[model samples]
Target chain A: MNVVEVTNICKTYPAFFLNRVSFSLEGGKITGFIGRNGAGKTTTIKSMLNLVHTDSGEIAYFGMPLIGHETEIKQRIGYSTGTISWYPRKTIHEIVDVTKTFYTHWDEEAYRRYMTLFNLDESKKPIELSEGMKVKFNLLLALSHGAEVLILDEPTSGLDPFSRDELLELFTTLKEHGVTILFSTHITSDLERCADNIIYISHGEIRAACSKDEFMENYGQPGDTLEEIFLRQEREERK
Target chain B: MNALLKKEMRLSAMLLTYLFIGFGLMALLPGYPILCGVFFITLGIYQSFQNAREANDILYSTLLPVAKRDVVKGKYQFVILIELCGFTVMAMMTILRMTILADSPVYRQNVLMNANPFFLGMVLLIFGLFNVIFLGGFFKTAYSIGKPFLIYIFAAFLTIGLAETLHHIPGLSALNAFGFDHIVLQISLFLCGILIYAALTWLSYRKACTDFDKIDL
Candidate 1:
């Protein structure tokens, strides 16, 4: 079953537009939403989450319209944003306390375990924590909710090499537990390691969608990295 | 709604401390009959503006399995909760100041001044103003499509100014004098103010939910 299905979604702004974008994430699979900075990847995610209004289109989660089924849809999904900010004064424990009221499947033991693993001091305010720690905190909250689907936007934008590797391992564990993941990022290395399916978006459109093996077979060379293939594809699309 | 209300109440508690300090300083002066009233009014307006600036936090909030209307309602309740808390604190301080000043010989000569109705009138006026300010501000913040603080300030200044001017009129003075002793009239006006606020709150919630539905995020 598809966890998310977006069709013919469009949203126009002054300088950019999301034009008739469509995609889907299957249950028990990790899908990477790949696009350049201005390719409307975030816009597409926002539309699917109903954060912004679409010009025209249909979006469904578990075969139900997202408009009326927001509560049900959100209950089964965990979401994090790239640029979203948390209150500076709130400690991780306080944030967790508040968030616990919203989700029925919240796992206190899992949350505490992640806190220990991430070395997150629940007493420290969010502003006092490093960017990597903040990201880890966000991931912990999403995961501890026991959500069936995780929708992360640029979840690894500012992390050290060690932290990035640990996050990938965490994602693997999540996938093994039957949780589907749909994440967007400019970091192709992370996607290559963690994503099973790829949705390549460029210029507000889906340039390609395929499995990781197919993506590698279609564009790979002996020494070509995913970044090189992406650059080459972007250059060809500009012509 | 309870979670959101709790959050707002906590924020209100923090803001109320600031308001009390300011009001306490004003109480030190003599002949400040309207200080409590103006304080509550200004505090309500300020809280509404601050809420508008922080509206983007709703992106994370809306992720919960709650209706958009509930989110908007939660916000409106927060504003109202702040207004009530601020007013209650101000009222307590006013009574305290009145008792302190009444015991002092310097203020005995001005005992009639102490009986000024402006504080009560100001409370009613501020409650009405807060309703209007919150409704206008929330609509702008939710839509992400307008100047929320500007609308709030304009409405607040206009209503307060107009109400103050009309209260000073000769004809309105008679209505005010009669209302001082008429329990029914006082109760009716109070209820009217509350009903108007409730209606505006509902309207704001409906608009915000519709706006959220349209948002692409």
Candidate 2:
């Protein structure tokens, strides 16, 4: 079953437009969403989450439309925006204390575990944390809520290599536990390591959507890395 | 919606939002227009919105387990909550002015806007204007504050000037009635203000929700 199905979603900006984007993520699979900057990766994800209203089309989660089932659907989905400039004066503990009230499935023990694992101080505010730490804190909140599907945008950016590897392992473990992920980033190496599917977008349009082996076969040569494939695809599109 | 409101109280509200209710006591001050008291109240709310925008409060709230429309609803709820709270304090002061101090020489001699139901009604009207003008206008772009706030400031001060100047006009002196001189009419004016407040605030909320839903951010 498809964990998420985005059908022909379109969003237009004065300078840029997300045109007729469509894709589906299979249940319990890690789908890597790859794009260069200004490629509408964020816009498409935001539209799917209904954070940005689409001009036309539908986004569904678990076979239910997002419009009527927004609160219910969002409850089961974990979205961590790379930016965490919200309530910068509030401490992490305070933010979490308030956030946990919205979800009936909040797991306090898991929250505590992620907090420790991320080495975050409860008293620290978002303003005081490093960008990478902010991302981890957001991921912690996403993970703590028992979300079945994680929609993460650049969740690994600003992390050290060791931390990034640790996160990749965590994603692998979460997948084994039946958690589906749509990981959006320009980091092709991360996708090369663990992604089962690829959804490559460029110029505000989806360029490819397929399983990993199929994507590599169609776009890559023998021993070619995911980065090489991405570069080649982008060059061809521009030409 | 309740959960979103609690989040606003805990996360987005500024410290001055609570403390500025004291400004309502300006209702009792002689020689100054009581209408300006609630203006101070709106100023506190204005500052909070400014700060919230800087911190991207709307983005954070939208990401939570709530609908995007609910984010706008929660903000309106918070604003109305603060407006009513400050109004309560002002009401107390207005009551005091209408009772024991009704016959006081200082109040009787004051040329400024008197503490009466008409005055209270004017304050409510100004607040309603703020809702539709400032708050609703902010949702148009969902990020810019200067334009909406400027429009609100113009509207609020114009309301204040009208309220202060109305009693001075020929044959309109009864609007300045004190010590229950025109209690029934004064109460009716106050009630009308309440109705307009309710209607305009409701209208603003609907418009804001619609505007916010169209925004990409």
Candidate 3:
């Protein structure tokens, strides 16, 4: 069964518009939401989460609608944002304790493991931590929730090479456990390394979506990287 | 709700401490312990307003599974909690001042003026008015990106007008009809204010939740 199904979603603003966007994520797989800035990736994710109201469309988590079933859907879906701003005075432990109260399936062991792996200081205030550490803390929170689906937006934006590699390994492990993962990022390399499927969005529309190997085979040239393919697709769309 | 309340209390603890100090200072100035009460009450209202702003944890909070209504209710609960703590400190200071300056001739007159039923009523009225203004202003500001100060000013005027008119009505004037000698009356008025605040808080929560549902995020 599809873990998430988004159909014909549309949202319009003065300068930007998302037109009839559609996508789905199945169990035990990873899907990459690939798009440049202003391509409506975040908007689509927000709509799926019911954080952004769509003008038209249907979104389902499992089989229930996202609107009235938000709390239930969110319980099973761990989410992380690109910019993780937290309460300045709260320490990581305090945040973890608070989050634990909300999720019934919270995995304390997983939380402890992530803390050890990331070298996160539980006693330090969120404001006192570095940007990468903040992201790591957020990732830990999202992962330790024991969620069936993980919706991460730009999870590798500011990480160093080592941290990024560590995160990729973590994702591999999560996938091995049969957890569905949907993440949006501008870093095509991360998608190439970890993503099983790609949903390429351009100008608020889905340009192409298929397995990574199939996408590479169809559009990728000899010595052509994913970045080259993305740029080429974007350039072609503009023309 | 617990998380939101803890976060708000931690951030507003300093403001609450300052309010206590202000009440203590007000009590020493003379016969009018009621003036001290009024001063502390207004300060408490202002603190609630400030706390509301400081509790804007939208980015992280929106990710949580809780409904938006619960988030708004948590904020109102925080404001009420702060107000109650401030009121308690102010009441203690008032009693202490009353005892200390009981025999002072100069303060005797001041005390009478401060303790007048009308004066106390007006203070309560103003506080209720401020609560409405603060909630409305915060909601208006959250909906748009324009000048919130102007929206606050407008909300203040609207709240003042509505509260004053409501208090002037025959039946609803019970809010201002507290008799200092009658403990029951005082308790009833206090309860009435709390009930009104609770109702408005629920309404505000509903408004916020519906607005969030309609918002583009």
Query: What digit string (tens of lDDT, one per residue) describes model 3 on residues B97-144?
Result: 345644556554442333223333333443444445554445544433
- For the candidates in turn, chain A alone yields TM-scores of 0.96, 0.97, 0.96
Off by over 4 Å in 1: B10-30, B33-56, B89-122, B143-147, B154-168, B175-192, B211-217
Query: Whose DockQ is greatest here?
Result: 2
Q: Which candidate do you rate higher for DockQ, 1 or 2?
A: 2
DockQ of each: 0.47, 0.76, 0.40
Query: What TM-score does candidate 3 get on C-alpha atoms?
Result: 0.82
Better of 2 and 3 by TM-score: 2
Docking class of 1: acceptable
Look at candidate 1 and tell me the lDDT of residue B212. 52
Q: After superposition, how far is residue B45 of candidate 3 from its true place, in Å?
A: 7.5
Q: TM-scores of all models?
A: 0.85, 0.97, 0.82
Q: What order do you get sorting by lDDT, best first? A: 2, 1, 3
Interface RMSD of 3: 3.3
* Separate clash counts for every candidate: 8, 0, 0
Largest lDDT belongs to which candidate? 2
Report the lDDT tens digits of candidate 3 across residue range A133-158: 77788788888988899999988878
